[model samples]
Target: MPGYLEVLIILFVALLLFGNRLPNVARSLAQGIVEFRKGLKGEPENQEEKKALPPAGGQQAHGIPQGTQGGANAQGSQPPPPAQQQDPS
Candidate 1:
């Protein structure tokens, strides 16, 4: 650990370099410390887990239409048929 005189010298140098920007620098340093502690605690860095999972009800994951999959029709409705294309001469 730095002695008192060494700490004072470091603070003097920082003041000379940062001048009026010292408060902003200090704020950023404090925030970095907070995030570091959160990381050490294994906290999730984002809110993704707070988001709702896919409903327990549907064919959503398999690229199948919502109302048709595994012989189940969500709305008891049939999907529209693919259009027949006629070639133009």
Candidate 2:
């Protein structure tokens, strides 16, 4: 635990360094963190999870519409079907 004097010192340093910009910087940092986490949450359905979806790009597979693998554009409503992607290895 930080001592009272240590806490005061930290606050004084923050006040000296940030002055009036601290709140704005904190808000921006929080928003950035939220966006970053949203990105990091990864593909919603994942490439491995199977779900019923409409035919993708007028193409059909096994009597069902073939769909784009995970990541954005997974939904049939998205613009032009995303190109098929494969692992580099």
- The most accurate candidate by lDDT is 1
Q: Write the per-residue lDDT of candidate 2 for residues 26-73, one digit (tens) a residue.
A: 999999997788679864544444355554685555654345445465
Q: How many backbone clashes does candidate 2 have?
A: 1
Query: Candidate 2 at 26: error in angstroms?
Result: 0.8
RMSD of 2: 15.3
Deviation of model 1 at 87, angstroms = 25
Please give, for residues 20-46, the per-residue lDDT of candidate 1 as tens digits: 997898999999998999899988776
Best by TM-score: 1
TM-score of each candidate? 0.39, 0.36
Error of 1 at 53 (Å): 5.3
Error of 1 at 25 (Å): 1.1
Please give the RMSD of candidate 1 to the true structure: 8.0
Regions more than 4 Å wrong, model 1? 1-17, 52-89
